[model samples]
Target: METLLQWFDLIGIVVFAFTGVLAAGHKQMDLFGAVVLACVTATGGGTTRDMILNVPVFWLAESYYLWIAAATGVISFYLIRYLQVPMRLLMIADAAGLAVFVVIGTQKVLALGHTPAIAMVMGVMTGTFGGLIRDILCGDIPLLLRREIYATAALSGAATLVILNDLDVLPGEAVVAIAVLVTLGIRLAALRWNLSAPIARMRSH
Candidate 1:
């Protein structure tokens, strides 16, 4: 189960990194900027997860994650010159990456003996921090802070996984699959329908 989760994490990282490179292209960044944003988006969430869990970073344990991020960044950089739908591709890939990461993150936290609440929070952080980092680096508002249903979707899936695991209703793989499906469904629906939380406002001075 642990090994499988690690593989899932690697997949999520690579996918997110690819999308990060895609998103970076929307700006007028140089090659170095693209690669930096891509790498940060790939590893930011997992690095935070490991730090909070008091474990060594997973990328340190296996070099594959590093290589994947670099390769994806490089490929995405040059490929974007010829790609006409970079934004759409980035959105889809980001959604998939978020779903996968949410499952792996929640499961890993549970394996570390944390409660469901902590697992859910960690899951959201793991799934969304990369994008948050990307947005910050790119001088945009962090998506997680918006009402785009991004973090909410990740949290819902993470919470469900923990609850199912606690009840012994599903094994690790099953939990991961269900969680990913739920996350993807909710996120895509929100995107399609433009579902968002209402912004709070203050009276004008």
Candidate 2:
């Protein structure tokens, strides 16, 4: 389970970094700016998770995360210029990265013997914060603020993992897989159907 978690973390970093690159391209940032933003987008949530959990910051403890972000940014720079990527690619990447990181964060908290509630919060945090940071840096409205079922999807996945694990209904690996699929499915469904949270108007005084 631990090994699988590490691999998921690495994959999350790569996907988030790629999203950062895509955002940078949209903003017309130069290479240095793109790389810096990519690193921040890739690791921001995990770094916050570790810091609040009082664990070592992931990139600082292992250089691979930052290196992967840089490599991804550089590669994506050329790929974007050559490939005719569609507009929705970023959304797909964001959904994937969100699912992966949510599992990583929730499982990490559970493995540390924390309560399921805290684990779920950390999971949502880890999933959404990186993209929040990316959108803010790119001068766009953050997805979390949008009507889309963003953090809600992360929360759903975290809850599924916690519930299934508590029930002991499946192996840990299976739990993780289901959690990721649940998240990815909800996100994709929302995108496909233009689903969103309803905004309520304020009551008159």
Top candidate on lDDT is: 2
Off by over 4 Å in 1: 203-205
Residue-level lDDT of model 1, residues 77-174, one tens digit each, is 89888868647677778889999998888888887888888888989999999889998988888879987889889988898788778788667778
Each model's lDDT: 0.85, 0.91
User: Which candidate should be chosen as best, given TM-score against the real structure?
Assistant: 2
TM-scores of the candidates in the order shown: 0.93, 0.96
lDDT of 2 by residue, 44-133 (tens): 888888899998887898998899999998998878877866769999999999999998889888988999999999989999899999
Clashing residue pairs, backbone N/CA/C < 3 A, model 1: none
